[model samples]
Target: MENYYVFIMMCILLILLPGPDTAIAIKNTISIGKTGGLQTMLGTCCALLIHTSAAVLGLSAIIVKSAILFSIFKYVGAVYLIYLGIKTLWGLRNKEVAVTDERKDEDKYGSKSCFKQGFLTNLLNPKVAVFFLTFLPQFVNPGQDTFLPFLLMGATYTGLTALWFIFYIYLLNQISAFMKRPRTQKVFEGITGIVLIGFGMKLALEKAQH
Candidate 1:
């Protein structure tokens, strides 16, 4: 029971830590509204499930043990994140006022796009694979059938993540009016871009454990 409590606390803290996931969520919410943010959140949750499944199935262990595989996943995820950051920053140059009604329709991202962004960002991060591979096993008892325990813990973590993001999305929506202002949106976009790139660089630097 004590271990379970500790695990829950740790999961909450980790979820609250700002990363690519949070940056995307905030960006989508401010730029596209609550529905976009919800779509993104759903995508992230689905990615978490995939990671959890991979960890349980021993696939994550294989990736973590192979240095070459780890590096390939790491660099790809890093480059994608960096690309997203650069793209966001570059888009700032094209003033929103210059967007005509037709252009606006063409330029706007749909629900699928937001969800995909969330899914790929979470899915591509090898660190998430490492996390599930390492973090979920500590709570299992010796001689226990590990499969059920691992699934339960993974589900718990996913549930907590979903709950937290829902609350976060709601809070952001409350401030949407002020945050949606042209100047505020630009400033936030700049900040989000830098944060995503920083996370990408950090992920790129991550070393595989022996």
Candidate 2:
């Protein structure tokens, strides 16, 4: 029970940590409104669900053991991050913060794009794959006899993630009056672009340890 409590706390803190996923979510929320943010959250949750299942099925361990496979994943993930960073930076020039944009049919396409971005942004991140494989096991009960504990913990984390992002998007939307200002938008977008690029660089330099 104590381990379970610790596990929950650890997951909460990790999920709330500032990172590429959160930045992407914020960017989507501002660009396409709450629908964008919700789609982003959905994509990330789906990615996590897949990673958890992969871990359960021992696929994650297989990736770790094969250096070539791990390297491929790492480079793909790293390149994707850098690509996102560059794309976000490019969008800064055309900044039209949709806090007040007229709703249009085209936004559905944009939302689908956002979903793919979020999905790939999460899915391609090898660190997340490794985290699922390594981190949760640390908090699993030593005497546990069933896979039920992991399933429950993973589901809890995924649900918490959905709730957290929904609340986060709502709060950010409330600040449209402030964030919609041209200067404010520039400053925020500029920072997001830089942070994303930095994460990309970090990922690029990361090494996979077996």
lDDT of 1: 0.86
Q: Write the per-residue lDDT of candidate 2 for residues 105-179, one digit (tens) a residue.
A: 437476887788788888888888788778877876678642666577778788888889999999988997787
**Alpha-carbon shift of residue 38 in model 1 (angstroms):** 0.7
Cα miss at 26, model 2 (Å)?
0.8
Q: Over 4 Å off in model 2, which ranges? A: 96-106, 143-146
Candidate 2 lDDT score relative to the true structure: 0.80
Q: What TM-score does each of the candidates earn?
A: 0.93, 0.89
Compare the candidates by lDDT and give the number of the best one.
Answer: 1
Per-candidate RMSD vs. true structure? 1.9, 2.7
Q: For candidate 1, lDDT tens digit of each residue in 105-179?
A: 534755677898899999999999988878887887767777777788888998998998899999999998998
Model 1, position 147: C-alpha lDDT score: 78
In model 2, the number of clashes is: 0
